[model samples]
Target: MSNDDAYDNSGHIPDAASYPPRWEAEALAFRHALGPRAVTNWSYGDNVRQVFDLFMPEDPPKGLMVFIHGGYWRRFEPGIWSAFAQGGLDAGWAVVMPGYTLAPEARISRITREIVQALSFMAETVPGPIRLSGHSAGGHLVARMLCGDAMLPAAVAARIEGCVPISPLGDLRPLIDTAMNADLGLTEREAAGESPTLLGRGLDVPVTVWVGGAERPAFVDQARGLAAAWGAPCEIVEGRHHFDVIDDLKDRDSALMRAILG
Candidate 1:
């Protein structure tokens, strides 16, 4: 594989091809099981991609848990991660999974703004403490929310309880040399400015960086770097890889879920 190709994780996870459908199937079933409890396609912006799926229990929610799907900022949507809402739903917390405009069509900064819009809308609509978590590129986006440039409203920003960036690319500079940059179109300044590692302890909310033990070294290092920079903790899911490490979000009783809830 080309050096750039190596940096693109789509080629690394052998089971990557299977996860979309698996998540889709699980999400569909979970939605069906939820019936009236689930709210799908809640729009936050004018763009078609600016929407989210929210799941809730019978009682008023104690808080909101939002999961951002990862596809290097260019692939996948919220539908594939809806099943992950199950854990929080069972715990009496509302869960939200948002879809944002993809790369190539939208620049990274634009995507960042789009997510901020989504978060702002949800914070107003849901009206509760919000905890954010994401995988891969989604992880990067969650981290970006902590930056000063995100421009979240004071009321909305204060409602954020915690953040868990899983297998995040905290440093975007390396990605400029990767094959995905053709789609990402990141300039040097943008790469440096957008990097969580470079931003240096911008978050006021608590952060917990997570990665799979079996993930690429770069991914592990990224998690470690972000944790160290933010004075946060890093949790490595044993034997999981980039694609499957997020599976823990589906299980309400898992340690990952506990960490998020805590």
Candidate 2:
């Protein structure tokens, strides 16, 4: 089936908007509760405008999991989702969250490059294997980071053990037809290039695609498409939605988290 046919969001736009308020509030609370850590800033380019926050563990971690926040490459920043690190921390994993120049200001290609640069920096500075994870738009970015034209350094790529993209948009063409694409300015070619499914499988690394059982059908289908394309496993988180699925990462027994850390 065509992407649009497979993942229809015709009636759930309003529900998608309302999914995040509680999660956002929880994230804010976590941000305030955590003690200070060494914050480092790295720039990809003048126009690209990329920055990442590295939350170092009080003790060294066995590996690092870099999280790319989802905002359709238009809205939201890394700071809002920093609470996610707690899950990694419990698993002895350090976390890196990066912010990229949003759409309308920078194109998708530039944003993708910025993510590559951010990952490159982390690979060089942070010692150990790396796993990638993100939610919604961030989830899409993580999948892109694993596909063709991946700008990651050979060393970093080698050290990447797995990917966990939660409720990702595996394909971008559908967004092109939606109101959300207004700022993205995604041409047909750009959409195809940005799509992980269209690009084919390039990484041998294991990938775990997770979505909330409560999420819009489109998101669940998006996760499934990526899993099918990459020959990875697709998981549905019980009673979760696009906004709250990441919260499961905080629970050690969460199926989504287990797939990621495994």
Candidate 3:
């Protein structure tokens, strides 16, 4: 298989094209139902994409959970993922869904920095332990925060309670040869600097590397590699593929939720 085929999540998932539209529709309705609880347009930077939507629970928040969306760091936005905030909100945690400039417009390094900015911005208002979750490229981004090079503020980094990176690309060097690299703009130099698995050390926050049992082999390898590197637990949800693996996140009582919230 070619490089892209190795990470071709959509081609293998049945009815793959329909998922985004369904997510978009669900997100629209979810935001609408939240009404005043859904705080829109909290800007973290000057760029248009540097805005995030904050979802509030009915009561005061218990803590903060930031769920980053993934499209290989090139697609999707905060608004398209509002529905995913349900599990966190219902569990009494304020959810922050932040948007960053996508690839081809912003390189991965810059995008990582944008996340740092977003994290600091969100932490300013919501006080409590901060947990993280992300899918695909988003998983990579969240992992970046724990790596030494991320340079997250000592104050903000210390508040991170745990991290759950779902189907993360722990190592970006392989992507350097993929067709998506034209858009991702990954390079050996950059990957060496950015790949979480290659880092010598990172923060001591509890990290659980999660991957769907049926996901592409590359993803499973990446997940195991991350867990091994960090000496964290690796949870593989059997029978789930890349796309559906994160569906568990919609249920507040799901194992995925408990793992991240803990």
Candidate 4:
């Protein structure tokens, strides 16, 4: 599928999966290449629903980058995206990838709470300011954290220096009309509560919204809406799509990486 087709209001998942074949292959390869020593699982709650993984650097790190993976808040896990750590690690940054309970099993509110708990664990266990980033569904979670909620525990909120959310779905109203809501089960009230566009106006922290140039127009619109609502900067990664845009992070000189590190 083409980028334009992916964003069509067809209300279908298969329609929006136009990520480049090479990107998907690389992501899968990276998931398989993870070394045992580089990844360690950490639990935020009593059971499996609270688990996360820390991707450590070979040398002492300059700062921490917490990555939240994307699967429309239903599928995927931290393990599948561990390969993303290579970019941050090479740049002397530690990476933390966390997983939250999927919808149907848990509500959006609970998922948000689990993210907070995961970050709290990181604050208590890891050192230094944290730079947050996420893709798609994960993007919304990271953006929501920028609200600097005292509920997160003051210390954790204070250590969050910046946030970067790529191809984020900031508004939830449209999802209610789309077939995607089958698993989300988002009522109007719950959808409003979870939308970053609605929650971002009160946020005081710095944020950079990014979208791949080749991403669906809806994704681009989502990024634009978030940046406009928050009064922050929005960046477009040239010739990239929802998936390949993340590869730019591996290159320190890439504009998206510069925005994150800047």
The top-ranked prediction according to lDDT is 3
Collision count for each candidate, in order: 0, 1, 0, 0
lDDT for each residue of candidate 3 in 9-113, tens digit (9 for 90 to 100): 999999999999999999999999999999987899999999999999999999999999999999988998888999999899999999999989999999999
lDDT of each: 0.86, 0.77, 0.92, 0.76
Give the top-scoring candidate (TM-score).
3
Task: Give lDDT for model 4.
Answer: 0.76
lDDT of 3 at 14: 95
- Model 4 clashing residue pairs (backbone): none
| TM-score versus the correct structure, for each prediction | 0.96, 0.88, 0.98, 0.86
Candidate 2, 6-91: lDDT as tens digits: 34432444466654565567666776666575363555445534777777766888788888888778787776676777778778
User: Is 2 or 4 the stronger prediction by lDDT?
Assistant: 2
- lDDT of the structure predicted as candidate 2: 0.77
lDDT tens per residue, model 1, 110-194: 9989998999888876777889898898999999999877888888888888898999989988888877889999999999988
Q: Candidate 2, after superposition: displacement of residue 133 in Å?
A: 0.4
Q: What TM-score does candidate 2 reach?
A: 0.88
TM-score of 3: 0.98
Off by over 4 Å in 4: 1-37, 148-150, 201-203
Selected candidate, larger TM-score, 1 vs 3? 3
Full candidate order by lDDT, most accurate first: 3, 1, 2, 4
